[model samples]
Target chain A: MKKFSAVLLVLAFSAAALFADGLSLADQGVFSAGGIVIQNDGVFDPVNGQYSTYGQLLHADHANIFYQIPENSNGHSMVLLHGYGQSRMGWMGTPDGRDGWNDYFLRKGYSTYLVDQPRRGEAGQTSVASAISTEPQELAWFTQFRMGRWPLFNMNSQFPQDEESIDQFFRQMTPDTGNIDFDVIKDAMIEVFDKSGPGILVTHSQGGFPGWTTAAASDNVEAVIAIEPGGVPFPEDKLPEPVDAGYYSVGGIPMSDEDFDALIEKPIIIIYGDYIPEDSDLPAERFWRAGLEMAYEFEDLVNSMGGDCTVIYLPDIGIRGNSHFMFQEKNNMEIADVIYSWLDDRELC
Target chain B: MKKFSAVLLVLAFSAAALFADGLSLADQGVFSAGGIVIQNDGVFDPVNGQYSTYGQLLHADHANIFYQIPENSNGHSMVLLHGYGQSRMGWMGTPDGRDGWNDYFLRKGYSTYLVDQPRRGEAGQTSVASAISTEPQELAWFTQFRMGRWPLFNMNSQFPQDEESIDQFFRQMTPDTGNIDFDVIKDAMIEVFDKSGPGILVTHSQGGFPGWTTAAASDNVEAVIAIEPGGVPFPEDKLPEPVDAGYYSVGGIPMSDEDFDALIEKPIIIIYGDYIPEDSDLPAERFWRAGLEMAYEFEDLVNSMGGDCTVIYLPDIGIRGNSHFMFQEKNNMEIADVIYSWLDDRELC
Candidate 1:
């Protein structure tokens, strides 16, 4: 039987090699983050299946937004907001790494949108490269040595210091650059909901902060599925002290516990990594603990605000050795599943 | 407080719009399956920090094997296989969808290999356009006319004839076009293990079939993690005749029950999706029964093979709906946790 199986295996391989004419590993090489270019093609109209307008959102920093129409016209849409320094492609499925939450919801019948957040990806208004090169002696000392070794503490090294820096960095990063106004996302989402009806918002890592803010601002947002939302900026008392150099602390955004409580009123599901300590050497960890804490605090806040909330703490299976980019880890599908189930249970979809 | 909260919400949006550069929804568009391509410039080494001679594997059929230097120098190197018809992208994290399992393992200090399986994605010999146009008329007729209106089965119209057709159909419908060829996936996995030491084979959906087969064929595979595996290929006597196209049947493969028994000897954690019926239009009754039966058959098969098999029947989260692709659905992270917890409990990782 073993021998026969061996022959069968060889035969199968030969057959596969032959019959699989169009298939190749080269195909895998084609689907990269950089290769995925999003083209804006009109608003989604349930009444008609025609897409009229087409263009790409070249963020002021030149980042791209990769979005897709849902497979079903279930009158609901979803926006996938990726974390800091990640591109819109971060939401696309990965071959060997973590696939954020796109596939899970796609399977669940939601028109999904993925965007490379501001100051990240190709659209980055800040250039980590230039920042490292152009720092003052005091800042430059930290930029060169401290930045490389301890990225979490070196904020100036990570993002632009001011509006001028933002412009300089983005101009340096990509030639085709335009600022993606947040209103565009909001307006598009509103249009989708107006046509498809109310929808849900799913966000991961730093993306969660903006997602929550979006939901808080819009009655059209039915629910928010946040995977490790960073920094509960309400009820100042409960909020963590801002990490000196992290992006979460930028723009003098208050991290007060009171602010966190007042910012959200939508049903939220928070999924956190169980295994990894919140304070890893990775720069992203600076906000990881804040995200987890916000998830907890927000749960209470939402309930108090007459909204629903649920939290699922995942096992540290891949967390202990990973960074705050847990959404991009191996066990992410499990995380996706948990979120899917929660949405389903709540009928948020 | 409600009015005050509303005012705060408005301020939050205004602040975000003023401070953060947002993503433009108008410019974001979907890249249909196989429309995007990835370029591999062998820069990052999965093993040591330095780049090595190993280039990306572009299979003859256009599938891909993105080989990273093993992160774990002394630990096992494993293949991170995605489900059918999905590309390596399925492993990356998405905000609103399922999270990939790749990130979990990689972060856990495991050396990983990601491949797009053959006949799916860019590696797919059959293109969606071709699959749709060239489907056997009879099968197409059956699906279009007789099969229920459920989208899950509706996509099955493109499946080729045979026991593996269901697997093939699901793969065809998945968005990632570059799929991992079973033989290439196995070979790459073996190579990684050889370089990085022993490791387990982690697989989801159709990927499970190859993982099981690979472990059974070689002594190098230390363990197996099968998440909602399809195509179990059970014994003829154990299953009903005709067997329906979606369920396992004695088809192209010549492996006998005994052969299956002889092949697998490693510890395996089989995670089954607990699906619940919701809509009346869904074939909930049939699906639930079939899913359970298949799960039972798989548990029995692995245990009979003298392998340490742990079967986890996940809680019926009404949200997974009635779809067979539960692993790819939202809120399924609990399933991932179960797998990880089982591994940790057994000290397998």
Candidate 2:
């Protein structure tokens, strides 16, 4: 069978080469977080087209990871976790058809494992079910993502503003099949890191919390690159007061000293895009400001605790016009380079 | 933006060409079944991360499709839909690591659009929720799929029976987020055809029902190639008596004459794998026999109604050792060739 696979692999690649003119990959496949079995004692009723789960195994609550290893691999994989109402697609390509962060990094010789977190996207099977809110929330997310007010763009916004682009963007927002559970998410992600071995961990939006937890819990997350993370981590003993952002508090997750120290032991970077006003009457802007405030506190705390942490406010760094999804904006490659440079500096690339 | 995209396209292709030795796709991207808008009347509260649905659009019940257009593609694409508890992954590759039907058809100069049916796989968002059953049913499915009974294999079974292969095979099984609704599925599929233009429809197992309905409802389906369809379609007025198979009835769906006629308008072919016993006390085998029996009836009914239909019993045609998922077995290419020949004869490829 192994020999058969080798022949087929060669034939497959050769056939691909024959076609020519697109991405060449050394390997690409998928894996899951694993599952459990349910032994049933039901009987088969053939007369009604009914059968028992009698000897069948039901696999559930597992995360799905789709990975691609480019030719001449770097041997270091980047595990990408997406934010709320989002999936691995967000990192695969931009709504406007531009190459996303995945391609950019792939070109730079890094393997990418794009994750569909448990209860979301391809990893939709869950132990607990949730009513998928079909409530219109695209506009809300647009504002929250800092793309701009409805049907309007922040001045010089890096997001592609064409109608098709916006439509595609909204279509990419997926609902969770189950209520979000941090522990469930972290466990699955740790398994991913375990399978992929030690590599960089990159999280965006809602994934940040679990990314941190997973990174701290597993030895496989060598470094962390967070893009507009929804929140940061704080020491449990010295938790900061929640910052009032009008509707929501901007308090980060409290963690044990051991977990905190383990997290800080590795290099960490938090990135914030443009359009997050320092102070605003607008709720979206105001909430983001509070979130940023917490990030600053996180940075100070991590560094003070002998951890390496860097916060890059895109505007302050003179790379402006980014919305919350900087890695998916028109200037996505530029933003990716910042991440690449950071990894390079640490010899972790 | 168009020019920018063009430039990126050229650069991306060239970059791919430089690497060589793997799949060279002219274009590959994702599109979704269109969704709805929820006009929410609400307010945003910044202090507690609370926001209203005002101006937000909620998209629901849309199917997700990932497509790859090979270089110098044949205009007639193949839209691949999966079976019960399975996703598009089944058609992409085998659990034992081998190229799947998609690659075979692609190499034959056909584009492939793999579908994750509404509320399943990547299309997990649904209007209604269902509890995910995480029972141990791998052995049951193994038997049901005719790969073999648990801890056993049918004589000369073509299934990859290695432990890892078995594990991966079971892991690929996914649960539906909601109850199965053929109308909803057909609706989403019709949209896929609408987007991709007229194409050949290929379906496996449970997908076969919706495949027929979608083809009936839309002119976009030029032909259909069904691999072990779960059941055939029957005329509503002349619905056949349900066949007693011990545990389940093997009666096909009843459709309006117009819909039935519309479905039969396209050339159709049904292929069943080996090991279906003419008489069996074993529920799985008995049930499959009944399913095959219906296929024969469906063939006669369609042909009698002045429509084209054919059934291929693999063993009768000198092919053997195939389980239900013949396309994912070692001889997947051979089975795909059978499909290609059918489409080619119809000039649909």
Which DockQ values do the candidates obtain, in the order shown? 0.02, 0.19
Model 1, residue A264: displacement in angstroms? 44
Query: Second chain only: TM-score per model?
Result: 0.57, 0.90
TM-score of 2: 0.85
RMSD of each: 20.4, 9.9
Local lDDT at B56 for model 1: 20
Could you give candidate 2's per-residue lDDT for residues A1-349 as a string of tens digits? Answer: 0001111211121111122246556656566764333344554332232245443345556678777777757879899999998888888777776677887777777888889887787776655667656455566677788876666788999898766566567767777877888887887788777767779999998899899999999898999999888888888877889888755688878998889989899999999999887787677788889888888989998888788899999989899999988888889989998999999999886
Candidate 2 stretches with Cα past 4 Å from truth are A1-21, A38-56, A151-153, A303-307, A347-349, B1-21, B40-50, B53-56, B131-140, B151-153, B234-239, B256-262, B303-308, B344-349
DockQ-based class of model 2: incorrect
Candidate 1 docking quality: incorrect, acceptable, medium or high: incorrect
Regions of candidate 1 where Cα sits further than 4 Å from its true position: A1-349, B1-59, B67-74, B95-99, B119-197, B234-242, B245-259, B276-288, B316-332
Structural similarity to truth (TM-score) of each candidate: 0.36, 0.85
